[model samples]
Target: MTLAIPDLPAVLETDRLIIRSPQPGDGPDLFDAVVDALADLRQFPASLPWAMEMPSVDESESFCVAGSESFQARKDFPFLFIDKTSRIVVGAGGLHRPRWTVPAFELGFWGRSSFVGRGLFSEAADALVNFAFASFDAKRVEAICDDLNVRSIRVCERIGMQLEGVLRQERRAPDGSLRNTRIYSKCE
Candidate 1:
């Protein structure tokens, strides 16, 4: 069964980061982070279609507003990862594609270019996994990424997610070539 929105915490904290639902004024920070990481994000265009074009400030604002609405509606949970020390948005990610019947969630994340080498993304992902299990009683949490995304694979592995399988030729890459997808999961 789906849990009430009020039962979920608006903010999830890790040792060095704060993962929180998008708020109205978060657009500028989000935009900065996205732009800083645009090249890396666009490398997997099919999986990140939104990164194909540069986003305007207004578009970013709208995205944040929609994220807030979606969170309230229990449609999706999009979050921004903020560094506790610098108070900068280091990345954005969330548990999406909810399967309430099975109590499952798909975790996704991307870090700002400047923050790519840090362990913050992995920390945030681990926290999200715990939140899904503890708050939603989720039976499973999964992460899917392009097979060539080594960084993402490392993040999944670092968080103790097991590689379930690789879906061969699952979709097309930006260059019109077949792309494989790696599926990783952590079960409660």
Candidate 2:
């Protein structure tokens, strides 16, 4: 279920980071992270479609507005991950509950290339999973990744999500090659 950013306390906090709503000022940071990690991101299904299709800064600004409004309207909860120690906006992630999925939400995340090996996605995902099961009253949370994305698979595993199944040749990448996808799920 899409959530309006609740007035509840911060979504998640670890010894080194805080995950919170993406603010207006984060557009540049978001852009930079995405651009910097384009090559790495292109290898994953979740980001391949957008890795090379960057819009103008003005367009990205508009997107941030829509994202914020959607978040506040209880339609989705997208967050920017911040390195508390350095005050850096290093990545973004989110939970999306489509109306058709009533009690379930899917998790999506990505990080700065430099931050990938530091366990940021794992910590952030664990935090989101907890928030979904606890505060959102979610009964299930799912994460799907390209079959070849080992890093993402590890993150899902670290968060205790069980490998559910595989979708055979579910997607055709930009290169027109078919790709299988792995699905992981956690049920309350």
Candidate 3:
């Protein structure tokens, strides 16, 4: 079952980017970002499920619909990352909840191929972490990245998340190989 989070302001403008709730109209743009970023994203096992299936516009629409509902239910909030200058959806970011652990949440994010190495992910992450702590009064915010995804690991570290530990072979990549997951966290 999918969970929902309360909807907030439609757009969150950073100095260089706008983070906002995605609309059905954003389906095609988001789909393109996902496809374009596939190779870079495949490095992270968390996104392995979508690596093979290049989603259609309908599938992307379903994603936005689910995201909208999830926001309304106070479950999770998935926002499209838009470049302020271009006003284009360049990536995605959000929070995830494990029902067993209410109130505390996990952070998830990914950027398009062109957005990498530009530090937007870290900026967006810091914003989301701040939101989780302030808006939700969350006791803890966490993130996990594949060991091989050095860029993501660096993003997490850049945002002040401490390396808690590494879970050896906890995840299997799309390539059918076991991989280590680096766990990181920031506390309230």
Q: Which candidate comes out best when scored by lDDT? A: 1
Q: Give the per-residue lDDT digits (tens) of candidate 1, residues 1-188.
A: 54564478979999999999999988999999999999999888867788999999889889999999999888898889999999999999999999988889999999998998889999999999999899888999999999999899999999999999999999887789988899999998
In candidate 2, which residue pairs get closer than 3 Å at backbone N, Cα or C atoms, i.e. clash? 4-74
Please identify which of the two predictions, 2 or 3, would achieve the higher lDDT against the true structure: 3
lDDT of 3 by residue, 1-188 (tens): 44344446666777788887777677888888888788877666553567666789888988988887787666677888888888777889897873325567788888898878899989888888888776776778899778888887898999999999999988877678888888899987
lDDT of 2 at 150: 89
TM-score of each: 0.96, 0.89, 0.90
- Distance (Å) between predicted and true CA of 124, model 1? 0.7
- Better-scoring candidate (TM-score), 1 or 3: 1
> Where is model 2 more than 4 Å wrong at Cα?
1-7, 45-47, 99-102
Worst 10 residues of 1 by lDDT: 1-10
Ranking by TM-score: 1, 3, 2
Residue by residue across 1-188, what tens digits does model 2's lDDT show?
54453464544787777888775766776777776666788776443576657656666566677778877776887877888988777787788763435468889888888888998889888888888877777888899889999899999999899999999889988777889889999988
RMSD of 1: 1.3
Clashing residue pair totals per candidate (backbone < 3 A) = 0, 1, 8
| lDDT accuracy of residue 169 in candidate 1 | 94
Ranking according to lDDT, highest score first: 1, 3, 2
Best by TM-score: 1
